[model samples]
Target: MVTSYVDEATGLLREDGKGSAQFEEVVLHPRVTVADASMAEAARAAHATAHDWCFIARSVNFPVRHEATVAVG
Candidate 1:
């Protein structure tokens, strides 16, 4: 499962009378369920690779953080 958290703050209004907003922070929470506990490391590695390849993560100017968790079931 993957969850995205974005923090935004309102910016100064423009002369056109429009409100502006900017992203302050972005956090991704990825929960990986593996068949075995030994796969935890592999799952984490995969998550890292995916993060690196993500277009949104790369396009954003602000930092994108990850809070990943692995569980065995």
Candidate 2:
């Protein structure tokens, strides 16, 4: 899932240094994910309605930079 999202973002956003002097991450979320045992629907719904209001997102024109991976079972 993380790979898919990264690939999709690569298409939507310039890969790293395609623009500007250079690109560097201002923040990194190390442990965020969706899980089967959690309230996925509620989380999705609330996030959809509230995601844009995030201070970091509103502050930057570039996409948030982070890497997320699930442990192989």
Candidate 3:
């Protein structure tokens, strides 16, 4: 989701404004699966750790955060 500020006179988004027409907050919902139910906790931890190592997330300037969930079946 994003929040943008528009120029009412020009009827255009203010690119230079504080909250310009840009992707401000990006939420990532990553779903992980584990073979064993007992390993669910480990899978969650790994997912969390993986974010720091992710190239795409690291390359982005804006906030690329997540609300992750784990499942086992």
Candidate 4:
């Protein structure tokens, strides 16, 4: 996720704009599994919750991306 932001900042990800940054959603690692669907859903919920706590959300110069890691047991 961080990679995506950095990439955009560095012009790795570009659209019509020459160098533009945008907000993006970062998905959890596919390794995350679910015995029940709720497990993965729970992890996603927690991740989304934690993202609100990050300082990067305040950054305006660069696009912000969050990394989600779902644990599999």
Q: What value does the lDDT take at residue 6 in candidate 4?
A: 17
lDDT of 4 by residue, 10-63 (tens): 223336576765534333232344455447677667657765765665554544
| Pairs of residues at least 3 apart in sequence or in different chains that clash in candidate 2 | none
Q: lDDT for each of the candidates?
A: 0.66, 0.42, 0.61, 0.47
Q: How close is each model in CA RMSD to the real structure?
A: 6.5, 8.5, 11.9, 8.2
lDDT score, residue 70, model 1?
A: 72
TM-score list, all predictions: 0.67, 0.34, 0.64, 0.36
Off by over 4 Å in 1: 1-18
Question: Weakest 10 consecutive residues, lDDT, candidate 1?
Answer: 5-14
Best by TM-score: 1
lDDT of 2 by residue, 1-73 (tens): 2211222232132355656453343344333244442444544454444445668666876656433333221
For model 4 the TM-score comes to: 0.36
Highest lDDT: give the candidate number: 1
Model 1 scores a TM of: 0.67
Hey, what RMSD does candidate 1 come out at?
A: 6.5
Q: C-alpha displacement of 54 in model 1, angstroms?
A: 1.3
**Clash pairs for candidate 3:** none
